[model samples]
Target: MATATTHGARDHARAQEGNRADAMPVVPASAWPDPPCAAGHLVWAETVAGGGSTHRVLARGTELRLTDLTGDACAHLLLFAADRPWERLNTADTVKVQWNAYLGEHRLLLSGQGRVLASVTADTSGRHDALCGTSTLVRNSRRYGDGSPQSGSPAGRELFKLAAAKNGLSARDLPPSLSFFQGVTVREDGTLEFTGSVGPGGSVTLRAEQDVTVLLANVPHPLDPRTAYVSGPLEVLAWRAAPTAPGDPLWEATPEGRRAFLNTAGFLASRGIA
Candidate 1:
């Protein structure tokens, strides 16, 4: 249902479907793949101690591989269209399309436009964590505090705020979001609290249907400090991703917020946000 396929096969099929005679070369395992910057191109990235890149998947058959390089690491992933940042990879729609929680090698990252962005073709470590989250504070702390180069740009929170505003979401509705690598737990009162790292080297893949702007930043896992620290480090890795057509499903919930996400997207598109 999610339209997932192996790297080689997917690319070949997309090439045939698009009737393109010329395509770019593939990524070598030893090198970091770079994504395309075309109007409809889509790409994925995995962040490590040192910044890295991914080879751009131009065709439907293109496949992406993200190596933890380390044992267990988390990646905060976000998606946007290369031509239209407003028309993005809505997480809520993705969850709905899959009709399940906890994405892994078994599941494919889907887009609101009904296409595969990436797929987890292989993984050495089976300890991929779901429920991780990302935000501006987390990115800043990890990058600047972790001895990375100084960032003259805005932080995650700021960027998110800007994106939200551009998407027509009020500041009140836009909160810090978590991506791959954060952890969470339901409480007795049915409350969701943040946890820590899930594990290390937990990689995930994303196949691109169209061009997307993927932002992977390190951040604190979703958890509430007040709760008991029963679980160990919580980590999540996202391997698959894709773009959706107009009026597509994203995220995996029946909550009002998720429904509104779709409505908001449509509204944005009406206003030319997409």
Candidate 2:
């Protein structure tokens, strides 16, 4: 395999051809912070589709930002009471309270019982999909009758089972989810349709209404082939406090990654998800 030096040499050669004035500085991997300390709180993680997945949080009052990182990424976001994991995010109530079909600056996340989760304080490239549901083997099987191991993991189904056992809730008690950074188009019938995302590198930031445990995960879609994944590694990052004013750190992590950990923690917390 070509070492970082080899890649650097190739980049230098390209820069020389472009001219010194046109060349851009290349930040080495070593120079960049190797992820952040905020990741320590992560309790659960899994390899997902797409490449370069990671997650992290900021300190109290510190702003945590989530970027799609790549274009066309659909992220499922959930939040639970930090003190009680059972009290999960309620997107339905959020939509009702905001009186909007889509989530954005106008909407705030609500818990299953109709409590505020977080407000959508910022949305870059305002194209997020609300109807696109969370990924699961149940949905996958309906899409593809039967396929190879590449067709989403049957193991992924364990998420629900685990949730049921941990929270003491039946499968029926799971909360509905919201998909972020997706495209929702109103059709001629005035119905919302799930299209592609707005574009790559879009993001959103939320200010917690209460102490909340956010959950995010990146698993292969039931329809995608596992062999095609470039880097299916799972990354989980957490922050003890909110981020500083300058902005949050850049992470290869997807919004889904954060939600996964949040879900587990919240479900187990005092709220009692079951």
Candidate 3:
């Protein structure tokens, strides 16, 4: 007879313990109120602990939302085209092409080829950074004494390395990352000022303009002046949604953005990707 506390993988319900698969999406309605889409539409959901990392391949039109559950969760993000590994997120072009330093809704995350990889579809947390990038092993070790993924103070780059490898990518594929929730400001002297994250429950959402592999690390912002390695929980939710269309308002927001969208559409069409 099986005990109430224990059960086999193929147990026939004799045990009363709570069990679930490793890859099960949480109940959408129970997870969060007012989700962008209905429960059935939700495709992915997970809560990454402080100083943790996550990776996922999102299909075109998927909407991913990252929430600062404790207000200090810094989401370091990297993106790569699912089909074409060479086409990766280019933070420099993302900033240079847009000619905007700050990020908000409707900002298209572009690739080096000037095509849209993802776009900021919704944002309640206005603070974001594309300049300082993520914490490195050297920086973390100097500041917190340990920089490995198992350490209390893990380097964002190292974490991303491990996540990237899971997707057949290497350190070279890990391009400069983008950080959300933690931000910076430019001083008059052209130096950077760390405007650390504040306020809880702030969330930012992005829509996949093309199939993309997203890698992330929820580590402390590199510029975070705090000596202690303070990390927080980050909630991730993704759902199926409609991809951008030619008539979308964002398509007409700017000439540069319009061009990027066109380029992305052309590529998708050429590949017969829907």
Q: For each candidate, what TM-score against the reference?
A: 0.46, 0.55, 0.89
lDDT against the true structure, per candidate, is 0.42, 0.47, 0.88
Candidate 2 deviant stretches above 4 angstroms: 1-62, 144-173, 188-190, 219-274
Flag regions of model 3 displaced more than 4 Å.
Answer: 1-35
Q: Which is superior by lDDT, 2 or 3?
A: 3
Query: Please, what are the lDDT tens digits per residue for candidate 2 over residues 1-274?
Result: 2336988779777766734221122122122234333444322222234321222222223333555655634455556665566776776656654556677753556676554556565688576655544556555455444322344333233354343444344556556667666556678998666555555667676665566655443433322333432223322223334421212321113243234335433543555531
Candidates 1 and 3 compared: the better one by TM-score is: 3
Give one digit per residue, the lDDT tens place, for model 3 in 59-171.
99999999999888999999999979899999999999999987779998989999999999889988899898999999899999999999999999999999999999999
Ranking by TM-score: 3, 2, 1
Give the winner by TM-score: 3
For residues 1-274, write the lDDT of model 1, one tens digit per residue. Answer: 2246587677766767533221122222222244423322333332333222111223333444444434333444555545554455555555666664455553545455543444444454443333434434455455444322234322445444444555444445442233554445556896665553435445555445444444443323333242221212222222333333434433333343244445544654686745
**Candidate 1, which ten residues in sequence have the lowest lDDT sum?**
227-236
Instruction: Report the poorest 10 consecutive residues by lDDT, candidate 3.
Output: 21-30
Please say which candidate is ahead in TM-score: 2 or 3: 3
Q: Give the C-alpha lDDT of model 3.
A: 0.88
